[model samples]
Target: MTVSAGSRTLEVKVLSAEGLTVDRKPVTKNVFVEIRAETLNCSTTSLGVADGARGSPSWNETLMVEIPPYARSITFDVKCKTSMGTKSVGIARIALSDFLGGIVPESSLQFLSYRLRNWEGRRNGIINFSVRVKSAMAPKYEPSVPVPMPALADRGSCGSQMRVPSGEQHNPRGVVTGIPVWWTNHSANP
Candidate 1:
């Protein structure tokens, strides 16, 4: 899928998760992580390693997702499937500043880890992942510089650009007229 306007493409690799537990028991199988960025739609990784030591699930899955313009974080929702149904194991909300902000380059790969929190807001585990920025956008607008209108000296020649001191108006030497000097980009208005 193409990155939409004002959005950035994030290549996120969900490597693995450690110390995950549901009810004081290590999770064994049917483990998956839903990767998303502040939206209902999400990209889910394949089931992690099925080893009995399910406490440490390994996914090693990479997903490309478009982050919205104002999104400053990504979420990893780890889930485990039980006989009853799917259950929330843990969730990690990772900030984008580590990889997207500051001096980080666009194509630089950043491997990082974050602590997960359970549905009840308890310390759960640590999710290891790597993220890279696929693309960057330039700022939309530059700071505007305000220019003052020069006071007209006479009707024939509206001349001289003078700096108006703070808290005081510009007083042309010798004499001053009420004629207003205007500068505009509108073509119709001269």
Candidate 2:
């Protein structure tokens, strides 16, 4: 007697006053759900199955949500559960900024700018099974325009080499000194 919700699948969805809000604020709502039980019958446990799957029994319930305004753009936690146990769910609040921040233009620069670096892995807890799509996108500067070398000015003349000031006493033991000009310009150099 393997009671099954015949060809059943649990679909998790979120709906609110509107798909978006007017004042650009988190639109609070009493979320409503319709549980369509198809396969599993009476005795089967909603333990677990697939990723992002709410391993639980079907129920028509309402949950409160604070859909943050786009200007604030936030991610908050929602505690969900089946008849079995509680699970942590994250709801992300999006706005114009979120949309713009995510859209990458189809260009070579876009490819070079946003590249995957490293993955630190997910959180650790009772419900630690989660995924973080770690990605980085940056604006690519066109190699500083190459400077062009000013056409060599005289061609037969000599060029200048930036020299460190000879008079400055360097504290080689205590604090490193005489760092390159560009290196010193950065905040982390000091």
Candidate 3:
């Protein structure tokens, strides 16, 4: 896949899951989640508890994923490992408008819950998570250190205000010229 240089980095926190079931039975062990943004690389969370404690499987893990700026949604695929093989539990798709839309600013944390659909497109469970855009691909224009413009500032004054000429010189005859005023270097005059 072609990756853009200005892709955004997402911090997706896989918080927990509730009411998850497969084949009409509650999930038991090695339950994990796979995150995807379109066709970009996928990130997976560590497996949850095996004993089916707390009435549900919980994986409070944070995953870092990079998504293209044009991606409109992300998918959360829940799966479980059985003695036979890895089984599909459910899938949850979250639209970009859900959190990345509206007046929300970048780097703002947005907590959300999405319903998971089983293989047959049936409601199976809910996935809870928080996501935030770490930063925009392009950095802001705020300079960390103050730039020193020695020629623009007066050494005698400690403030950052520009130094003005001591006095204004009037034309010899107070005559106005049709030539538009142009900038010239004072040092070049000498």
Candidate 4:
């Protein structure tokens, strides 16, 4: 499979969160934001935690992440730290297309707000953030060279081609324990 490259980077600023809850109880203080792309790469707030605020908390921090062209959305995991340990309040998935505003310019900031959903799929809170796409320079193109294909062995009525490596023995499973298997056959022939 060929992997395509992206042309821009996303700068995300996690502003704050409001009306958050954990297990039907209002969360007050020690709240932080965890932002992640659908691709699994993530970033967490590094500064002071939002503390002492019940239900509503403020962070006002910025996190920058590269946005691959194939990425469709980003997820935010909101949690609060307490004596009992950290508890997840809710998560928010924001589509890149919704805030990217079609064609991304050199540097454009977009303020957005989305509702947060708990693991049970219920509305739990709201998270505010700002996003922008940093334009990238066009890549220079070059001529490509095609690689030659390897030769294939002929198969008889058995419909299977076997290649035994030098100084290696094949187990009953047709695999050499310590050696790598470069070819495989789907035929029933032994």
Candidate 5:
């Protein structure tokens, strides 16, 4: 449950899952990790590096995530691994949920539930990490504003360019232009 800043990416590593139980039974064994990441304006990508020695190792696998151009934030889930004398299994209750909540919006919390269900009876040696991103287009109620008239101006020989005012500006019709009128301290509120 630790996150560090990497070069142009994030290094998220799962410390360990505490108080693990199986079928209403307390179990004790070495538990690994399955990390999943989902963000806005991007698809879910699984991260891992190839290594002969299994288990968990620091610097073994660095979750190098590139910040999406339009992404504001991301969310992820961590599932712990269990061993049964020779078979490694992924228990549903052994998973924990955490998110980097910001301006980004995820698809739904239900998806995490679905992933936990997938490991019901399967004891796969490999830890499964499912990562998904909710694009900025998920919002359906965003209202559009009218383009300002003053923003439009001729560039001489090339073509006419349109500029829109942003925030607020003096308009006789009480219309808030979308173009940015000022970059410094200037309030258009009236």
Candidate 6:
């Protein structure tokens, strides 16, 4: 399906994260953020893991995402890489309405914060960010005319249609009347 010109693109900046906890202990280092959208197309983040400097991690990264008119929300998955494996610290779901509520002007930056939820549905931390919806060009409507299809050839009778070689014969219902070539070959060999 073709996207209309009225579709918007979003600019999301992940500023920082704070007050994170994993297994009841403060997460002071080795954390990374994974950003994704409800639509399968757009998701991005800072390239490498952000090391917490003096126990505070600041990503301050910017991502430009194409927000189709049908998209509803974007999700953030915060994880920490450890010796064992990556552990889920928290997740945040930000609605598109938060930025496109019609109260804010197009292409204006708005900073916001959301409470992060862990795997067990417990509060884990807070993520700070800014979002802006890029202005879209007005849609141009054009008149559409349907094209006519070509006519097919008429096959009056099944016997008049093209037939394959061998003893097989096709009836009016298009079913073969004679035995198949495989059975005839086996019977002849036996």
Candidate with top TM-score is 1
Q: Write the per-residue lDDT of candidate 5 for residues 69-90, one digit (tens) a residue.
A: 2334343332333453422234
* Highest lDDT model number: 1
Better of 2 and 5 by lDDT: 5
The TM-score, computed over Cα atoms with residue i paired to residue i, of candidate 1 is: 0.70
lDDT of 1 by residue, 1-190 (tens): 7666567888989888888888998775688999889988799999998544454788889999888877878899999989899999999887777677557766889899989899899998888988898865432432233445554333334433333332213321112224444554333423
The number of residue pairs in model 4 that clash at the backbone is 1
Residue 83 in candidate 6, Cα distance off native in Å = 1.2
Q: Please identify model 4 stretches exceeding 4 Å from their true place.
A: 1-4, 47-55, 101-106, 137-190
Q: For each predicted model, how many residue pairs clash, with residues at least 3 apart or on different chains?
A: 0, 11, 0, 1, 13, 0
> What TM-score would candidate 3 get against the native?
0.67
lDDT of model 2, residue 41: 24
C-alpha lDDT (0 to 100) for residue 32 of candidate 4: 83
Instruction: Score each candidate by Cα lDDT.
Output: 0.75, 0.24, 0.73, 0.67, 0.32, 0.66
Cα lDDT for residue 3, model 3? 36
Check candidate 3 and list the clashing pairs: none
Residues 1-190, candidate 3, lDDT per residue (tens digit)? 3335546778999988888887898875679999998975799999976434456788879988777756788999999988889988999888877776357875788888999999899999898899998754532222233334455222332333222222224221122223222344454433
CA RMSD, predictions in order: 14.2, 22.1, 17.5, 13.1, 16.2, 17.1
lDDT of 3 at 58: 80
What's each prediction's TM-score? 0.70, 0.17, 0.67, 0.62, 0.28, 0.63
lDDT of 4 by residue, 140-172 (tens): 333233333353343322223333332213221
